[model samples]
Target chain A: MSNLVQTITQSRIWRSFFRHGWPDNPLDRSLVMTSNIFFHLHPVKVNRKSLRATYTFGLGVMAVILFLELTLTGMLLMFYYAPTVERAYTNIVALQTQTPYGQLLRNLHRWGAHLMVLVVVLHMARVFYTGAYKPPREFNWVLGVGLLLLTLGASFTGYLLPWDQLSFWAITVGTSVAGYAPVLGSTAKAYLLGGPEVGQEALTRFYALHVMLIPLGIALITSVHIWRVRKDGGLAANDDR
Target chain B: MTNIPTRTPFSKSSGKTYTLVELVHRAPAQMIDHGPENTVFAFPVVALLELLLTLSVSAVLLFMSLTINAPLEEIANPNQTTDPAKAPWYFMGLQEMLEHGHPTLMAVVIPTILVLFTLAIPYIDNDRQGSGRWFTSERGKRIARNTAIYALLVMPAFILLDNSFPPRELLRGVVPDFVAQTLIPGTIMAAIVIAPLLVLRRSKPNAREVVLTLFTLMFVSAIVFTLTGFLFRGPGFELYWPWNMPDGYNPFMNL
Candidate 1:
């Protein structure tokens, strides 16, 4: 088994695929992080203190995981959904009852949206309580707040996609709150709903935001948020001891 | 300008290996006041931990998705509004706030100010003394706990009191609209938020302590408002016990 693994690793194709050798040695391990895009968000070394489960409760990472889950399930849901006042509700019914595992898909997306909002809030609380937002990380915290808002946006836009009475009324109420703003209120509400009320135009706009605009913003901002973590010296816990 | 001689590995005259030397003694790599380096490579350890977290979170989400299906109510009807007509669960806090005062103040102004204040916290408390420590110190933790307790008691009381005798309604003819709707409720909320900071001023609290007090107040108050708006509000958007919600209106369905 070892020989087979070595042979494959030594092959040109495998070497080209992974620039580093097996990550058993220090040099290869460092290369593994620096060379890979996904792993590059992390530093080559992390302080032992930061790894404690109690310190972070892993809420930030859980938020990211939930985001990925939402993205996947959301894409699948899109395959069965259409953003129209007439068909949106029926499409949801069909998704739940007709499509295979469609109910589970919608369920995961729905629950994940709620969970992401929750975990992001908890993560912010954890950061604040731990003082992780202190110097050099202050901007990261700001970005995180931006990300939190984006998460809310993503979830809110998705909320109207179901087109049921729950979504319709919830959105009507939500957007009306925006209309309470002083000068730009009505304009913002009209822009959001594509009119004075939730209708086909609102559905189209929300669909665009839920699937494209907000998720893209989240993806881009999340990258910056994690990259800033590495640049700002891993976790704030590194300064504890 | 004349060029300065650059050091070389080999000497021209001797045609032999040469060296560039310095006479000064440099400081060693170690330094005082620096603690022992305690760290681990991120590749295996962090990667493994993240993998474990992802799997566990996914499992929990899957279990939840399987057991409790997401709510899908009747078709959209513009003419017939839901009893409460609440926002998404996350925005329920803001909606609840709207019940207390004018929509502009309760929904827009206060929430906007809170968001801006939250974003400004790190800048406001820029001292680097206790970056990683939970609640900064013993005093900070005590302040946070007390502030939380205070908010826990005060916010619910405020909610219930304000609900029972809403200034917006009770003082409608007694006082000006601005005073009744905006000023009264606004002043009360400001007092609730600022009372702890006023108390902390006597002790000459550090920036961290002050932030702890303020954040705890805000965080706990948000919880109170959200819980009230979500679980407690029932038909006609009126406050009620969660289990006793009228017309079979389950708040969880709003999720």
Candidate 2:
């Protein structure tokens, strides 16, 4: 068995696939992290204090997981959905009734959106209460706040996609809040709705935002947010005495 | 490990011997005060932990998706509005605030201020003395707990009081619209937020303590308003018990 494993690992194909050998030893373990795309977000070594489950309750990880789930399910949904007013509602009805596991897909995306918002809020609270936002991490906290708003944006824009009475009225109320802003209110509302009210223009604009613009912004910002975590010396828990 | 050379391998080629030496700091710095080095390799451990989290979160989501259906009402009809129409659940706090005063003040101005305050917290409390600790100290925890309880009591009372005898409604004919709608409610809301800071000031609280008091107030008040709007408000957007909402209006369906 050992000889076979060695032969396989020593092969050029295996070496080309993985830049590092088996990660059973220190050098290989470090190489496995540094050379990989996903694991590269992490440092070669992490402070043991930061790994405590109670410290973070893994809310940040959960938020990212939920985002990935949304992306996957959302893409699958896009394959069947048409953003047009004539087809949007029918698409959702067909998804719920006709398509295979379609209701489940919509369910996951919907509940996942709500859960992500809740998790992000709790993560912010955790960071604030832990004093993780102090000093060197102050800007990271700002980034976190920005991410929270984006999360909310993603959820809110997606809320309008079903093109139901619920989505229509909910958005009408939501955007009217933006219209309450003094000078720039109406312009912002018009820009968001793409018209004076919730119609085809609003539906089209929200669909583009829900499926593209907001998610792209979130993806870009989340990369920066995670990178900043490493740049700022891992979690603030490491600084605890 | 000791067999490893302390100098670079190229030293022999350059015909100059080099020795590794530890440089000591002459003055104290931020990095000097840290505790013992307690760390582990991130590769397998963190990777495994993340995988576990991903699976568990996905599993939980799967269970929820399998059990409950996401709400889908009739097709989009701008002509027909849902009674007690609401924003998304997270924005219910702002919607609840709208019931208290003017839209500009409740929805736009106050929300903007809260976001700004949240962003400004770390800068305002820039001290590094208690980073990574929950609530910093026992005193800090007590302050947070008390402030939270105070907000829990005060915010609901303000909501009920404002709802029953809304200054915006009662003083509408007597006072100017701006004074009745914006100025009075704004002052009351500001007082509610600032009163705790004033009490904390008597003790000459540090930056962290002050932040704790303010954040607790804001956080708990947000919960109160969100719960109020999301669960309690019924038809015509009037306040009702979550269990006893009129017209069979189930807020969960709005999610």
Give the worst 10-residue stretch by lDDT in candidate 2 chain B: B21-30
lDDT of 2: 0.90
- Per-residue CA lDDT of model 1 for A44-79, tens digit only, reads 877788999999999999999999989999888888
Candidate number with greatest lDDT: 2
Model 2 Cα lDDT, one tens digit per residue, A1-241: 9999999989999989899988889899999999999789999988888999999999999999999999999999999999999999999999999999999999999999999999999999999999999878899899899999999999999999999999999999999999999989999999999889998999899888888998898899899999988887789888777
Among these predictions, the greatest DockQ belongs to 2
Winning candidate number (TM-score): 2
Candidate 2 residue-wise lDDT at B69: 99
Please compute the TM-score of chain B alone for each predicted structure, in the order given. Answer: 0.86, 0.88
Q: TM-scores of the models, in the given order?
A: 0.93, 0.94
TM-score of candidate 1 relative to the true fold: 0.93
Worst 10 residues of 1 chain A by lDDT: A232-241
